[model samples]
Target: MKVYISADMEGVTGLVDAEDVQPPGRDYERGRGMMTEDVNAATRGAFAAGAAAVLVNDAHGPMRNLLPDLLDPRALLIKGRPKPMGMIEGLDSSYDAVLCVGFHARAGVLGVLSHSFMGHEIEDIWLDDQVTGEIGLFEATASAYGVPVVLLTGDDTACAEAVAWNSSIRTVPVKYAKDRFAAQLVPVAEARSAIEAGAREALRSLPSAVGAGARTLSVRWQSASVVSHLTAIPGVARRDDRTVTVTADMPQLYRLFNLFLRVATAVTSNPPYC
Candidate 1:
């Protein structure tokens, strides 16, 4: 089996605040270390489960958070962003399964450090009329390539969301959320064990964890101006001041979603666009 891992920072073990996931924060470096360890655990587990190869994509801000030198030597890492596929970049039908590590709840949800792709711009993401967080978005992208999301690790809310999307998916909840920036967490060692075990169990379950069929995707921005800026893309329709809707097959929808995020990010934070 070939396994692909998409890793994020917000849901890593012991992460409960923005400072943990961003630079200049006292614990930021520690958070990256924890994130790397968690991903290594998952990769190790996948190899133990008979996976012939594993690839990890760093899916957080700037997409370069994962420390390449410390990552598991067995797996290849895709870092940095502005890529066509974004989170699920390099994913294709060739992979046997995909895994989401250190993921968080959707925007406005009660998970620790909860937010969609761009917390400052996206208020919610909709797929086929259902509200979905980052978990759903990445799953859809993987599904588009005929890959199943076998495992997910994060806080309680993120784990719950994974199972809700696909009951067969295995999840390792490293922490229980008390609020947006507060969580009851297990020690790093325990969290690593859980992730490793969860990856093995999820892969062992096989075909049951893979499901794909997304027809429409949409997003609601934090404000009308953000949505207005995104509507400039052809085929993207303005649903309302805060919402924009797009109808496409899974692959197209995934690309459109990434495009929306990139444009939104540029408009909101990048000065050149402003």
Candidate 2:
């Protein structure tokens, strides 16, 4: 089996605040080490389950959070920005399964460092009326290529969301969230063990179940200017002052979502743009 793994920092064990996940912060360096270990554990599990190849995508802010030198030598790493797929970059029909490691809950949810695509700019993202975060979006996008998510590792809320999305997919919650910035964490060693076991089981079991065949992706932004800018794009409809809706299926839906993300990222907070 071949697998694609996407790694993020916020939900990694022992990390709870922006100081840990964001760059140039006091704790950011330590957090990346933890994230790297978590990815290595998952990769080890994949290899143990007979996976022939694994690709780890650094999917967090700046898209370059993982420590490549610390990653499992068996797995290839993809890191950088301007990636159209964001989290699921490099995903294609050739892969048999996907593993989402170190993910958090959607914006406005109770999870350690929770937020959707763009931390402060996005309010929520919906797929065919179902409120979704990065997990849901990644699952849908992978499904578009006929792939399923075999294992997901994150906080308690993120694990719950995974089960709600697809019960068959395995989950490992390294921490239980007390709030957005705090959690009751499992020791790093224990978390690594759980992730390795879960990844092995997930790949050894049946294929991951595909999610709903969503036809629309609706985004509610935190700023009206984002809504205005997105509306100018052909086929994007303004649903309200803060919401814009787009229609597309599977792969295209994923593509348009990223396009909107890039556009929304450019919306300035200064006047005239705000």
Candidate 3:
């Protein structure tokens, strides 16, 4: 069995500020180490459960959060910025399953550093009218390729949010979110162990179906012009003042998502647009 891990940063232990998630800052370095530890736990678990291989995609900002030097030598790391698939670069139908690491609750969720893609620009995201965080949307896309999301690790709010989609999915809550920047944390060692257990269980008892479906991403922005700006993309629809939705025929929503939203982020953050 091959496993794919999508690693993000907001829900990692001790990550309580925006500065922690950004590059060139002191906390970012520290946070990346924490992120790597979490991924390593999952990878170790997959191995313990008899996984043949694993691919880890650095799903956090800049897509370079995890240091290969600290990563498990057994698994491959897909890193860097501007990749075709942002968070999920190497996903395909062949992978047996996927795991989400250090993921946060959706926008407006009560949790540490909680927000959707842009935080400031995106208010919410929906697939098939169900409000979803990055986890849910990624789960849907992964399912489209016949891969199941077997494991998730994050804050309590994120775990709670994930349980809404699938009760059977295993979760490791590294922190209990008290607010956007504050959470009650489990120690690094404890969190890592829980992650390993969740990963082992998810892979060992793999679900029969991962809920595959059409790949469509609907983004709710903070303003109308952001919607107008994104309309330049072919086949994109401006649903209203605050939303723009895109549909893809393939399971590569992550790449298309990066293209459109990176542009949206630039446009909306500009003075005249917001």
Per TM-score, the best of the predicted structures is: 2
Where is model 3 poorest over a 10-residue stretch in terms of lDDT?
Answer: 265-274
Writing each residue's lDDT as its tens digit, candidate 1 over 1-274 gives 8899999998899999878988767889998889999999999899999999999999888788898899989999999868898888889989989889999988878998888877756777888888998888788777777788989999999989888977767889999999988999999899999899989888986763344554778788776877888878888888888999888778778878888777776667632101
Name the 10 consecutive residues with the lowest summed lDDT in model 2. 265-274
- TM-score for predicted model 3 compared with the true structure: 0.93
Backbone clashes, each candidate: 1, 0, 1
What overall lDDT goes with each candidate model? Answer: 0.85, 0.87, 0.81
Candidate 3 per-residue lDDT over residues 1-274, each given as its tens digit: 9999999998776677777877776788888898898899999999999999999999887787898999999999898877777777889888998999988888887877777777766788887678887878777777777788888888999988888987767888998887777778898788888899889888988885545445677888777877887888888888887888877743656567778667876775532101
Candidate with more favorable, higher lDDT: 1 or 2:
2
Which stretches of candidate 1 lie above 4 Å from their native place?
A: 208-214, 270-274
CA shift at 41, candidate 1, in angstroms?
Answer: 0.4
True-vs-predicted CA distance for residue 115, candidate 3, Å? 0.8
